[model samples]
Target: MVIRDTHSLQLVWSSRISEDSTFGLRWTHSIHRSLVEEKYRIHDGQIILTEMSFHDYGIGMENELAPGEKLDIQDGQFHIRNMNRHFPALHLFIGQVRAGHTLLFSGTEIPLGSLHAPGAAITIQVEKRSILNEIGGY
Candidate 1:
């Protein structure tokens, strides 16, 4: 995943560990630079990133989705809202996500993820926002 806003930016690489687990590396650019490595697990329908290591930046952080928090991953499309201490707010939209393919609707047709299976690889591009609170109204 690559998140780029006017105030912050992030680059992420993730690998599936199991049916509901993943390991990731994220680099954030803001007032300073930060490199974070983390593990994520799905619990009660929410994905939580834990066991994180933040290098270069002077803060420790974690990212998660609460149990009731929802992701609109229905009908092969989705809007992803991400918040983290290491970077600015981000919003991502995928036109399709399923086994063997992933498509982004933000006008970039860059192919990401494995062509052979689901969860093999994933990539996301965060749309930049002009205002901090304007989220494109998913």
Candidate 2:
């Protein structure tokens, strides 16, 4: 098998959000580019990226995906909140998850996993602050 050379691109920034735009998370490096790759586990959170993936604006631009583009999940905003019952996932992002008013994360996938898995399983958790803490209440 030919191995692809993925540049060591650190996670410059990261964030999370819900379908209703309830809560979210953002990573700001004290030093620009302080992020690292293969260390996606944040706040003791780790998710295996499924073969799920999709381009931006999956609603209107659903047609953009080619015949074998290989899109596992979606924008995540609508997905994580209200799982696409239509398409169930096998891999998941296990973490402090929530639907709207909690501090938890559904199963999150890495870029690689998100690039392949068809479906995923997510676990939820409780949090004191709204997802707004990570993001600006959006």
Which candidate ranks first by TM-score, i.e. highest?
Answer: 1
- Clash count, candidate 2: 29
Best by the lDDT measure: 1
Which residue ranges in model 1 land beyond 4 Å of their true spot? 1-18, 57-138
Q: Ten residues in a row with the worst lDDT in model 1?
A: 93-102
Give the Cα RMSD of candidate 1. 16.1
- lDDT of candidate 1? 0.33
lDDT of 2 by residue, 1-138 (tens): 001112332222234522222222222122232211111122222222212222233332234333333434433421222122221212233222221111223443233223222222332222234556446464
CA lDDT of each prediction against the hidden true structure: 0.33, 0.26
Q: After superposition, how far is residue 104 of candidate 2 from its true place, in Å?
A: 13
- The sequence of per-residue lDDT tens digits that candidate 1 reaches over residues 1-138 is 232322233333222223343334333423334433343444333445443444343333323454543333433323233322232222332213322123322333323332222333233332333433353332
Which residue runs does candidate 2 get wrong by more than 4 Å? 1-21, 29-124, 127-138
